[model samples]
Target: MREFDYQRLVIGYHGCDASVRDKVIQKGDQLQASPKRYDWLGHGIYFWEHGPARALEWAKEQKKRGKLKTPAVLGAVLHLGSCFDLLDAEYTDMLAQAYPLFVDSTKAAKKTLPNNRPLDASDKDQLLRDLDCAVVNWTIEEFEKDGTAHFHSVRGVFQEGLKVFPKSGIHRRSHIQIAVRDPACILGYFQPPSKR
Candidate 1:
């Protein structure tokens, strides 16, 4: 990995329920010391600002661990009630090992929405087509309707908007802004380029 000033922190994100929140926070703090040690693909895909290369690395590691079946990456928009949800990377790392199964539990794309206003079909379809990876948003109240809802891969979804520095290789850059963020916090995951 290239040396950078980036600091790894685990921000608290609202869970499906109170118990879930408690468990997540507890895990977050534990992994704060070594956040990168965890296979972060599922959650990092959307919620993180770490860029595409890091996200792809997470996905690759997860696949190696058998945490995920496919190389495809995805993410969720967490609604952590208040914006105060950051734990140290060490805690996240600890959490990753403590609860191996929880790492992949975030498969279903979800966002922390305040209410049940469904996304327009045409607009939503267009948004999905624009992304290079699959995405799903969930809220606390409304449960996602599996069949009626769509799940798509990044190649089948977004288009390029911006470019960011690569995390590890030479002269490589990442494409950004493939889709609009509904709540601003939930930036969609990136379609990381395959190793060159």
Candidate 2:
């Protein structure tokens, strides 16, 4: 994991209803969205919107103007509510509070895997193990022409044992593939001063 510098973030949640949209719009800096999933009859997804570069610049500016409480980077906003239903977990508070920032950036993140399968007891163990070795830091890379940010990190763990369990009764321990991305990269669309 790597350290990033960003400023001025927009964090929000997008669900199936107007209420979800309203809450995100009210708390976030900007509201960009799309349609909900068919299953989202009354709920929405979420995402955090921000640029790492501009945010850092803003922090510097504030520091110059003596507005900062300390010469430290401002934290990110993560939406726990958005991931709750998506992850099918009743409690993500532990993960959220443990991490400095946890946000639901968009409904796009809620999409289930194409080959969805129910997790059995062995799969559950693998998931817990992978989570324990989760990535903690990230970096943001941007494409100048497209303004698209590519997030990359070196912290994710990939387990490598695909077959061993019984097909019908026992579950196979498929390796976990943790995807890493930089929260800072999301800022490219907004144009942060550091990059501009």
Candidate 3:
């Protein structure tokens, strides 16, 4: 009867095409979950936690990649129920422990674990997180097999972009992100307020 519920609510932003945003906000359409194999947080609906600016920036980048025509941001009220928060040391250690298990499973299946690769030589952050994705997905499967901790959401902190200043560890694009595995956790969707 124990649930690892965080009992916290937060505003999350999703970046997409302008049409997609209108459908979800005005027509009440469901936002599709991203299932990319190299997704940073495995397969789920991704969001920028309390970060509308970051979310719009991402949409713009997606447009450059031909993923969308016109960038847009959608706001949502999220309940971080039963979240596997990587910002905490506990979940991070658990993920490290899950690595070998993930390796073993892939080996058993006669497959190789993919590595996180950079987009280009200049891409130091290694945006393609195949290895991280596999381990996270495997860990969730372990929980499912155990039938104890079926997490409804996952939260992670990602440091990205160029340094704001020389000799500074702070990155211009550092932000906290979330992946909602359960659609029910999304209380409602709204139009993001314009920048003040």
Candidate 4:
């Protein structure tokens, strides 16, 4: 991979319950990391890059579903140390190499490889992506075993839905996502300025 200046900081936004936002502000620390097996970008604290509106939308949706009492957006400044950036061909090539090993391991364990299923039969807006998540996490684990590389975070751009215009691969829901594997990378957090 090309040399990346890990000292540079980037802005990210996260959606959550208002109460959760308040706790982070009061504690002066990042929210707890998520280590779910099916985490899309592997186990980490996820954030939408420069996507405060998107974060708010997600929070509002959660509130509508009764999962959250109040919607809010938290902005963060991240120091991406040794980031595994999928946008770069070098990292992607590395991941490609790791896939075969993952497949072999799963086969040896007599387990079916997870598949990316639609969130709902009628909703194409989202995909489950369990397999993708598994492979990525597995790749990281394998790399760590080698003791040659350690990634503090993973960053990728996802394109969802059809293009807004003809012939354009860009999708309506295209957005950048960052999964911070190391909590120390998050320098600080703040509530975003209210759109209202």
Candidate that would win on TM-score? 3
Give the alpha carbon lDDT tens digit for every residue of 84-113 in model 4.
899889989999999999999999999999
Report how far off residue 140 is in candidate 1 (Å): 15
Worst 10 residues of 2 by lDDT: 135-144
Cα lDDT tens digits for candidate 2, 1-196: 2344322223321112233233334555443322222111111112212324333443455567665533222222432211112132322343345333212221246732222122355543332222222211100111212454322221112223343555543233222121113333233222212233
Better of 1 and 4 by TM-score: 4
What are the lDDT figures for the candidates, one per model? 0.28, 0.28, 0.90, 0.85
| Two-way TM-score contest, 2 vs 3, winner | 3
Instruction: Quickly count the clashes in candidate 1.
Output: 40
List candidate 2 segments past 4 Å from native: 1-120, 130-154, 164-182, 187-196
lDDT, residue 96, candidate 2? 46
Output the worst ten-in-a-row residue range by lDDT, candidate 1: 132-141
Q: Over 4 Å off in model 4, which ranges?
A: 1-5
In candidate 1, position 154 carries an lDDT of 9
lDDT of 1 by residue, 1-196 (tens): 2222222222212112223223334443211111121111111223333344545554555567666555432333322222111143542343344343322443333522122222255332222221111111221011225343222210111222222455533332222221112232332222223456
Q: Could you tell me how far off, in angstroms, the CA of residue 30 lies in candidate 2 after the best superposition?
A: 8.4
- Better model by TM-score: candidate 1 vs candidate 3: 3
Q: Model 4 residue 158 lDDT? A: 88
